[model samples]
Target: MAIPTPGQPVRGSRSGAPIMALFDLLGRRWGMGILWHLSQGPCSFRELQQRCETISPTILNRRLKELREALFIERCDKGYCLTPLGSDLQKLLVPLGAFSRTWAEVLPHEEASS
Candidate 1:
């Protein structure tokens, strides 16, 4: 079966916004984890499974298919790795990781006061 791609209809929004399509895909179970691990370097399916511990083979397979269809990653002799587009995505996510650390530190205090 063909995998879904951005610019197509997606859940939670009918506008067909590219961002919504992206979010819908990434928000799936272990989707982000797959990207994060691939950001470092190429990895075989087994290696990916080890890095993303607790992910069942079924879900991992599904996410890989989705990522490939999105042009975010590709499979090569070395293993599965990010495409140039995916590497660019990793660059974009770097700042978010920094922000997350800051948010993480502040969130506990805010929650305690609530």
Candidate 2:
């Protein structure tokens, strides 16, 4: 799928609202994970693959390309790193991360419930 662009059709939104487009991109498999990992520091392709242990090279390459096109990441001498816009987005997600941890603590595990 092409990178979700604002004003273009995206999942769930015919108008492709900016936020919906963002959600479409980040909601993709391993998309948010890649960004989260890169928030720590830059990583080479191999290193990123190692970080996302189950991600196929093809998918990783695709995600990297998509992220680059979105201007959320850039290829630098060191490796792939978050762009300024990406950093801002990451900061915004920090609260969501905290909320998820708290929610996880309260939610019953499926295995245990079973």
Candidate 3:
């Protein structure tokens, strides 16, 4: 499948914001997880499947197709790895991971509500 063009509608947004389109794509199940695992390095299908222990082949193939369409990943002789654009994206995710760790630490201390 081809990546949705900028003017095309996606998920809940017809506004055609590029960011919204990206979120719509990445919001799919295991989307971010797949990217996270790929960040470690290129991986064969079996290796990636092992990393994402719970994902089914059907979903993994589907996500790979979509991500390729979006130019975020590619299959090489060794296996699948991030494209340069995707590597840049991985860099951006580093700060988000830091924030997530901070949030997780604070979550345990936050007051519970009835």
Candidate 4:
């Protein structure tokens, strides 16, 4: 979770934060990657790190903190899992991720491989 400063809210209602706030909160360095990895299932911090291809401890920690405060995730005995809102977000992202993958497959990188 983001380190909530005194006199500042950790997060506000969806209407309260702007689109940029949502993007800025989750699109920060390694932020989406953390969420994407966790989307599969809850995993320990170390497991999450490994799944994220060894994102630096500092950045991973920061993203986790931000995600927590945003109410997009929760920590459990198993590890971190998406909140109800977050699961909704994940559902939304699935198509985006599919598009990204298919788009990339059409790029020169794939052409070069084949």
- Separately for all candidates shown, the number of backbone clashes (residues 3 or more apart, or on different chains) is 0, 0, 0, 2
Clashing pairs in 3: none
Across 54-99, the per-residue lDDT of candidate 4 in tens digits comes to: 6998988778877888788999998888899888887877898889
lDDT for each residue of candidate 2 in 8-83, tens digit (9 for 90 to 100): 9999799999999999999999989998888989988899889888999999999999989999999988789999
TM-scores of the candidates are 0.85, 0.91, 0.87, 0.77
Q: What is the lDDT of residue 39 in candidate 3?
A: 95
Candidate with best lDDT: 2
C-alpha lDDT values of all predictions:
0.85, 0.91, 0.86, 0.76
10 residues in a row with least lDDT, candidate 3: 1-10
Query: What stretches of model 3 exceed 4 Å from their correct place?
Result: 1-3, 109-114
Off by over 4 Å in 4: 1-17, 110-114
Worst 10 residues of 2 by lDDT: 105-114
State the lDDT of candidate 1 residue by residue for 82-104, as single tens digits. 99998888788788889999999
lDDT of 4 at 34: 77
Model 2 gets an lDDT of: 0.91
TM-score of 1: 0.85
Instruction: Candidate 4: give the clashing pairs.
Output: 1-65, 2-65
**When superposed on Cα atoms, how far off is each prediction in RMSD?**
3.5, 1.8, 3.4, 4.9
